[model samples]
Target: MKEIVKFSFISILFILGINIVSFSQSPNESSLGIQIEKNPEFRDVELYELKITQVFKIGNQGKDSIVLKAPTTMQIQSPQLGLKIDTIIGVSRYKVAQNQLIIYFSKDKIYDFEIFYSYFGNVANLNLIGGNLGSFYYWDANEEFWYFRSTNTKINEISISYPNNFYLLESFSNSKDIISEGTNKETFISRSIQNIPLQFILLNKLKYERKRVVKSNQYLYIYLPIDSTRNLYLNKNNIVKKIESQFDKVICFFDEVTSRNIDVIQIDYNKKGRALGNQIICDSSFFYTHHLLHEFIHVYSEIRTVKNDSGYFFLEESLTEFLAICLNYNSKNRDIYFDRKIAYYSNKSHANKSIFEVDKNSNENWDLIYGKTPFIIHLLSLRLNENEIYRILKDFYIHYSKKEVTFDDFSLFLRNQSVDKEVFSEFIRLL
Candidate 1:
């Protein structure tokens, strides 16, 4: 009897130990948000899969129940898009669609799971400032709801393998020139530019001028789309030539931002001042001659960074803004773009700090990463040589591409090149 009791106790302890090892402290503990981990292997232009098990720490401040709630449905969506894959699942495993799944963990527990499928279009993150992940209610959990800034985003087609009836009927613009159609049937694709694979259609028909701006090494890349009808044309040959000239391999991607991901440029007109930087989805009412030059420099330099839907908010837009201000401000491509005002509203910290400064506190607020970072870069340009500045910027992009370069990457690049690190460091310190 004594031996049996001891054996039972040992077994219980062993099981408990296994459970503890299965999970670590949730990263979402402080914020109660989520983090998406990319799949280890690349499946063509497949975007990173969010391992739902990859624990996303929920923010403690907002609706605390985000952790406790067993969500009945999840919709990956935007205001322009009603496209979603919503299903209800609890403790049981759910093989809802072809490539997606839902598995359950214990309370305050997390694990990694995957939904694998080919992408129909783009996958973008919805930004809900001051919103907590827990605020998104799962009808089952009775959680409070929080609002998000639903800009024009890339919505993927999950049911392509399903019957054609499941897929959204695509519509295109009647006039190839009409860029936007004020919330038409299709979310991202122009209404008139219809009946074709959007990636192929966008790649083939898109044509925009390089806007005769001379490159002096340092430059900015801005994609500006005008009107609610976001149609920007690109002559395939020009695109091929320019892209081939810069990158060793060129690919036209409809969704996902890795090495060669490009999206329809969207910029704001005179009115609202919410999400800033180059609007990736909507068309800008006014086009800047220098905008092409700035964007060209990013591709030309082969700034081989893995930018996602939010990368523009995090790095690309701020860097592009900084580079554009420095290059366009001095170049002949200058034009009145009062409509495309700079507000680093998308990712605020970068708007205020050094271009490479990683946000120490993920939950902090920022409104200037777009506007202010450029001024700092411009200031740096004043002290550094245009050629040196250009080389530095290019090197920064290339070196960072080798790995994720933080603000420290800039410091490391300077040291590795044996350039006087102080030249740029002093500028950063001053800022």
Candidate 2:
């Protein structure tokens, strides 16, 4: 009976806590906001350790205690900074859990204090990709960009400072006070930090030849090392034209115009080939026409506004491969494509596992996810007309483009389409 009462009391507190967070205003005000300063020191070529300093202020508005959420990655320096005012006490305790740094303290009558800490590490949010010309990093690519406070926390002001030689090339920031010094320092201040992802490019000024190719309703931005000869220069334009033609065919099939600009980075010394959705990082040796189209198909299928982790491979990988086949089916390589596709699907390693269970991180058995799953889509296309199959996919795209999607969601879409019930039944059974 005692244990039951304890559980009941805890459940009541949980319910009340949810209600309090939902309905009531927080009993704390930002007297002095957070100021974050980051300095990056190069450890090696394109690798650096960043020292981040964050100073924050909190004022207790009521006589009741309050808690604030910080990043779990935050390392608080010992001997916390604050005065021991009767009303305004320092943070008495802190706990890290659920990806949150929970700060606890006793409330004083409108008392405030400042806390500061410095941490040194490789900024996971920042990646320095080096090419023959130079290196650059994208602000949006950092998963841990907002390392100070939890989202939805009202920050009155924010200021971030970068290195001296880093040029703020492009900014999608809504923050004001955007300034750049002659020595190549950039700083921006925001009154209220918007709860949106920050995406910008910070480029170290280097000698490079950049070609901006604009074709019919599509754009390609290519960056190459300036050391290339005139013949290689012409080859660069030819590569761009070939990729543009391939993209044109995909776009024409989908009946969708290009929504985002594509960037290709060609570095002679860097041979790490990758397609980062909108950006392609490759050496000229690996930047062939087929490789370009494979990556561009990924760019075409990036309809999700927010990523849904589970079963996202269906749209990102499987659908992409299926579309690639469609793109080549009418071409001269039709027989070759089908032969390779059959061999890939017939590989017996992952025959037992369902394609719906496949993930992007499946390394050894990636052929199951990327290669075998296309057969499902192929079967659907064979059951229905090609146009009707694309219509179903496009309809799925329209519904889940701006939102996360799941395997269940895809199944429902297939069932709800204007196709034969037997066909849909067979598809679901195969899954």
Which of the numbered candidates is closest to the native, going by highest lDDT?
A: 2
Taking the candidates one at a time, how many backbone clashes does each contain? 46, 1
For all predicted structures, in order, the TM-scores are: 0.36, 0.64
Residue-level lDDT of model 1, residues 1-431, one tens digit each, is 00101111100000000111122343332111111222346554222222111112222323212222211232333332212334332233433322223334444543232222221122222221111100010111112211111121111111111111111111212223332223222222222332222221111012122222112322222232211232344333443334333222211111114322233332232321211211122223212333443443443333444433233333555566556554545432222221144332334434444434544313342334544455555556656666677677655665555354444445566667655667657765654
Report lDDT (Cα) of residue 200, candidate 2: 43
lDDT per residue (tens digit) for residues 17-65 in model 2: 0001111234233322212123234234443233333333444544343
Q: Lowest-scoring 10 consecutive residues by lDDT in candidate 2?
A: 9-18
**Local error of candidate 1 at 309, Å?**
18
Please give the lDDT score for candidate 2.
0.51
Compare the candidates by TM-score and give the number of the best one: 2
Report every candidate's CA lDDT.
0.31, 0.51
